[model samples]
Target: MAKSDESTVLDSGPFYHGTKAALQIGDFLTAGFRSNYRPEIVMNHIYFTALVDGAGLAAALASGDGDEHVYIVEPTGPFENDPNVTDKKFPGNPTRSYRSQAPVKIVGEVTDWTRLTPEQRQQWRERLAALNADPNAQIIN
Candidate 1:
């Protein structure tokens, strides 16, 4: 068969969003929420990851007292490579991180993602604290 003229989907992602919020299937996760990394700032974009472990790490580090969650999500509109981790922190999007201004629907949930050990979690917490303490540090928004 001849190739069609229609455009192709950008990223074939089984994308995951990690957070402490308890969300149900069909729920919409949008921007304007306080950033998990910097709670003071309302983020302009909602971030997600293709790596399950990366999502897990995010969930683990997510603020608040609720249980960690890794949600399987589908982006409702266009998304772009998250510059926060792409070329700024790591080159070439090694984290497979992305962000969207549009909502991402909660299609399902994932439970088997690796959880951080208590010690590891603490270590990560300390690292975050140090980063937060740095006056030079900034989020890409």
Candidate 2:
């Protein structure tokens, strides 16, 4: 019997947008309470959800109230570059630099609560009151 010389290889390239930025509230409930001065009233509320498309990404940044706390959601991806190599002079040679894309910028801020309707304000107040009364309200994972 004789041995055969055969091998397999792979190629890699940049395909997607790389990085994104997000703003997280250090203390959401505390900030809301402090702003409204009403433990039973929800003042600052922010929520964020993200989805990816073919070549672009979309995010929803919303606030329960017109408070000063706003939600920010950004895009993110793997930081490491591909390992498969091509265009090499030799087996153990550096081909091209392995570089990854950078994060995109996503900024947001709470403007004013005055824009909220009376019904919306009342809804927020009720939600806050419920949370404040429930000991398990802090459980968010």
Candidate 3:
């Protein structure tokens, strides 16, 4: 593992680790806000971080962290509808068409897996292995 002076070591085996992994996966996707809505308005670049408690996750990630590095994914469109139509109005508006936007999907890569402490790596590996062993494992909350 190539150690970088900038990196700091954190504890392993907490629920935060899984949360971090999931958020890291989400951040890998480059789909930023695409519209000019207040929520989608550009403020700065987005990154992901994790918290041990789900409430903490909701608070820290949804609210501005010290670094302004986290984002909370929320529903911005209808839950169900025809893909061909954008905005589904009453009887549908023919002139005012709203294009359907694709949901963001992220893929994660452990760029410095070897850099992790032995214990940290082991914990992560075990967590991942357990999930793989049982696809039904409720890893995400």
Candidate 4:
């Protein structure tokens, strides 16, 4: 990985990752929040970080994050927390807490989908065409 003077990316392991708005640069600096410790709720796991795919991440950002850097993070072992916890914040039932064993990093900045390059647009179009061709693919508005 190319190391910039600002920061460097570190690999944890084959795990899930999530994206959250950089509420502020301090957002990434702060430790992750877990649901298990909440007094009102039954404790599940100690260290939980939410993980989502590109589409899910986009939906999450649209629901809240906005124009901010999305912190992509993954967790390691200590499988104490339930990684599949349902998030009440957004529809479609996206997972909330994933277990993170390593420090999180600023992966990329979020921007409008129209900002995609022609190459990216073409690739997405091809992928969409393939999905549309699949009889089992559900077309939702």
Candidate 5:
């Protein structure tokens, strides 16, 4: 059969929501995490709301207290924020979103308790232990 011009509906994924702690560990062991929709956009990186010095993390933590996992990730490529790419949330919502051209690398994770179970953590550790390991291989269930 010849290739069609239609697109296939794949599984809903690229889910960015997970226990912050688990995500941190995963980020540390793999490509750093990229900044999502932020209220501040000081750098060339596009932002949502006005600049709030040192308040972004605090606001995020205050709002997301349940999750304690923190991932220190770095961008793997340039930020792609163009007029057509900028995503606005809603009327009152001050959250703006952007997508990275390349995946990020995780540098380290900080969590009070391991989000993943022992077995799961072990599996992730093992899977991410290879020299050329796929960063997305570890999925925190």
Candidate 6:
């Protein structure tokens, strides 16, 4: 319901960030880490989504042995539609994904969302491995 500097209504959300990092409330999520999907490149923006399930998927797919975590996040500054999914993978922003160079403050944690089955998790890992092996696969960072 709030307007951004550009005057567009911001997507009021209980946004979430998913990862395997063990973080407590009030921690900040920032960019510059290697991409979860494409670990070769450092990310310029930290990504989050309005959908809890989407965040859950991100945590499940994250590369780590630590337990998956989905944190309720609040943007500290401006954010924009995630170009990776909005333009290249899907039209518009149905995924409700966004990215920001600014940090996201962790306000809470989500623990009730569905978790991927072991079989499903393995499938995702295999798929990501195949994509990593591809010489031309790209993520529209």
Q: Least accurate stretch of 10 residues (summed lDDT) in model 2?
A: 51-60
Over the stretch 18-123, how does candidate 4's per-residue lDDT look in tens digits?
A: 3333443323322433221122233233232333343233334222435423344333233322223322223332443333334444343334322345576467
Most TM-score-accurate candidate:
1
lDDT of 5 at 133: 55
TM-score for each predicted model, relative to the true structure: 0.90, 0.27, 0.22, 0.28, 0.27, 0.88
lDDT of 4: 0.35
* C-alpha lDDT of all candidate models, in order: 0.85, 0.29, 0.29, 0.35, 0.31, 0.86
Query: Candidate 4 at residue 48, lDDT?
Result: 26
TM-score ranking, best first = 1, 6, 4, 2, 5, 3
Models, CA RMSD each: 5.0, 18.6, 19.8, 13.5, 16.0, 2.8
Candidate 3 per-residue lDDT over residues 19-135, each given as its tens digit:
222354454323253211123343222222223232232222232234212223322222222212213223432222111133323343322221344575467556656655674
Q: Local error of candidate 4 at 136, Å? A: 32
Poorly placed runs, candidate 6 (over 4 Å): 1-10
Report the C-alpha lDDT of model 1 over 12-31, residue by residue, as the tens digit: 68999988999999999999
Q: Summarize candidate 6's per-residue lDDT along 61-139 as a digit string, tens digits.
A: 9888899999999999888878777756676778888888889999999998989999998998999899889988787
Off by over 4 Å in 3: 1-47, 50-115, 138-141
Name the candidate, 2 or 6, with the larger lDDT value: 6
* Clash totals, every prediction: 0, 2, 1, 8, 15, 0
lDDT of 2 by residue, 1-141 (tens): 111113212213222211122344342211132222133444332212221221121111122332233233232322221222212323431332221233322343332223345676477667767766777544221
Q: Report the Cα lDDT for residue 2, model 3.
A: 13
Best by lDDT: 6
Error of model 4, residue 18, in angstroms? 4.1
- Scored against the true structure, residue 124 in model 1 reaches a CA lDDT of 98
